[model samples]
Target: MTDQLDDLIATVQEQERRLVLTRFTHDDAWALGSLVVGLARERGLPVTVDVTRGAQQLFHAALEGTAAHNDVWIARKVATVRELGTSSFLAGLQARARGEVFEDAPWIDATRMAGHGGAFPITVEGAGVVGTLTVSGLPQADDHALAVEALELFRAG
Candidate 1:
C-alpha cells in the first residue's frame, strides 16, 4: 500500500507539475475537495466542495439545501485537523466495506439516499498532511471509487 501511495504521489506530481508529493496538507485538502466536488458536478451529481474550514463547517450549509440523492458536498478542515473528520468517515466505510451502516455522530442521515462518502489523506514522504481528497453525491461505493480515481490523477501528475 505504501508503494502504491508513493506511485500515486509521483503520478500526481508529474502530471500537476507541482511539488506537493510530500505529506498531505490543508492546502491539498482544499484542492482535493474542490476538484472532486467540481468533477462530481460535471458528472451530473450536483455537488459542491469547499476546504475552507473543517469538513463539518464546509458542508454544514450545503446539507441544508434540498438536494436529492447523488448530491455532493466537501470541505477542508483546519490546518491541524485538516480532513480528520472526513478521514474518519472513510475509515469507517472501509471497516464496514461489506455492508452499509447508518452513522449519526455528525448527525447525518445516511440512509436517506445512497448516503456514503470518503476522504483521503494526501501526504508527502516527510512533509506530513498536505491535504485531503473527499467525494460525495453517489452511493458510498461509487463515492469511494471516485475519490480513488481523483487521488490517482493527483498522484499521476
Candidate 2:
C-alpha cells in the first residue's frame, strides 16, 4: 500500500479503536441520528444519514436538496460495512490501490456491496462490528468524514 493510503487507514482505524461502545441501544441511534442531522445542517450540506443495527434500520433521513441517488449510495455503502467490518473508505482505497473496481472484488457481492466512502462500522467494546453509521451526498472522503464527525460528537456527548 502507498504511504498515503496507509495513513488514511490508520486514521480511520484509530477512530474505530477510540469509539467502541459498551452497549448500543435504540436510543443511541436516535442520538446519533440527531447529531448527524445537526452536523449536516450546521454545514449546510445536502446529505442523507442512515444508522442501523443488524437488519433493523433505526434512523434514516435525507436532507432537502440531496439527490435521490444518495439513498442508493447509502445502501451500497452499508453493504460494505456489513461484509467488510471496516470503513467503506478504506475498502474503496484498497480496491483502488489494487487497480480494481469494487464490483469485481471477490469478497462480497458487487451488486449489493460498495467499496466507497460514507459508511463506518459501529463496534461494541468486545462484540466487534454490530451496526453501521453511513452518510452520503458529498464527495466520498467528505461523506466518510461526516460520518466520523457525527460519531466523534456523539462520543463526546
Candidate 3:
C-alpha cells in the first residue's frame, strides 16, 4: 500500500502548494464551506464538512444523510492532523504499516485521535498549516478523496 500512499502524499503536497491562501478570513471560510457543500450536494454525498482554525470553527455543515456521529469522527480526524501534520488517512495507514496502532501512539488519545480519513491541512504559503478542512461519512478512501477533490476544485478557481 506504500505505493498508493506515495501517490497520495504527492497529491497532498501538490495541493499544499497549489491551495495556499494569503489569509483565510471569515468570509473565505464561508465561501469555502458553501463551495464544499455544493459539491457534496452535486455528488449526492451524505457527509459533514468542517473548517476550523485554532479554537475557532470557521465553517460547518452536515449534509442530508449524515448522522451526528460524523461530527464526532471529524473531530477525531482533526486531532490526527493536529498531531501528525499530515492527512489522517495517511497517518493511519503509516501507523498500521509499521505494526502500530494509532490508539497507542504516545502523543494521541485514542478516544480523541482518529487517524482515519477526510481531513486535510489548510496551508498558508509562508505561514505553514493554519487549520484543517474535513469531510466524514464515506468509506475512508472515498472520504479522503472527496476532501482532496474539494480542495482541488477550490484551487482551480
In model 3, the runs with Cα more than 4 Å from the true position are 5-14
Which candidate comes out best when scored by TM-score? 2
Cα RMSD for candidates in order:
8.6, 1.5, 1.9
Q: What is the Cα-based TM-score of model 2?
A: 0.93
Candidate 1 lDDT by residue in tens digits, 31-71: 65666665665766643333432233333112222263323
Q: Over all chains combined, what TM-score does candidate 3 have?
A: 0.88
Off by over 4 Å in 2: none
lDDT for residue 3 in candidate 1, whole number 0-100: 65
C-alpha lDDT of all candidate models, in order = 0.44, 0.87, 0.82
Better of 1 and 3 by lDDT: 3
Candidate 3 backbone overlaps, count: 0
lDDT against true structure, model 3 = 0.82
> Candidate 3: lDDT of 80?
85
